[model samples]
Target: MTTHVQLHDRLDYQSVMPLMEELKAITDDDLVIDAGNLRHLGTLPLQVILAAVKQRAARGQTTRLANASDGCVDMLSLFGFTPETLTQPEVWT
Candidate 1:
């Protein structure tokens, strides 16, 4: 089954740790991260997502970022990421 993790409106330092912990706890199944409601995108949260995507790849599990907000898209672009690239990890690697 696919696991869905919904991102909060504000992904700042205070809340990013718990978010990272949640991502780290997923050991099996595919993951779909919902960024539709994301208002603020922070570097820490982006790192957490990248790590989760990498871990899932190592385990042969899929990780997709869905419904990304404009803010999320803009922030990701700063790091050379596009919305489509989030679902297709091989594109950047």
Candidate 2:
């Protein structure tokens, strides 16, 4: 089954740890991260998400980032990540 994790408005230092922990605990074969509410994106949370993606990739699982807000898109692009790349770990790696 697919599991969905909704991101909060802010992903700064104050919230990164909990986001990372939540992402790490998801053992679903497929993960759907809802970024529609994201208004800020921190490097730490980005790293956490990437790590989660890579780990899932190693297990032949898949992760998808969905409903990205404009802020989320801009933040990702600032880090040189396109929304398309999140679903394809190999593309980012």
Error of 1 at 16 (Å): 2.4
Checking candidate 1 for backbone clashes, the offending pairs are: none
CA RMSD of all predictions: 1.5, 0.9
TM-score attained by model 1: 0.87
Per-residue lDDT of 18-86 in model 1, one digit per residue for the tens?
998999888767888999988887888777788778778878999888999998888778888987786
RMSD after Cα superposition, model 2: 0.9
Model 2, 1-93: lDDT tens digits are 999998998998888789888988998899999999999998888888898899999998989999999999999999999778976888867
Clashing residue pairs in candidate 2 are none
Task: Predict model 2's lDDT versus the native.
Answer: 0.89
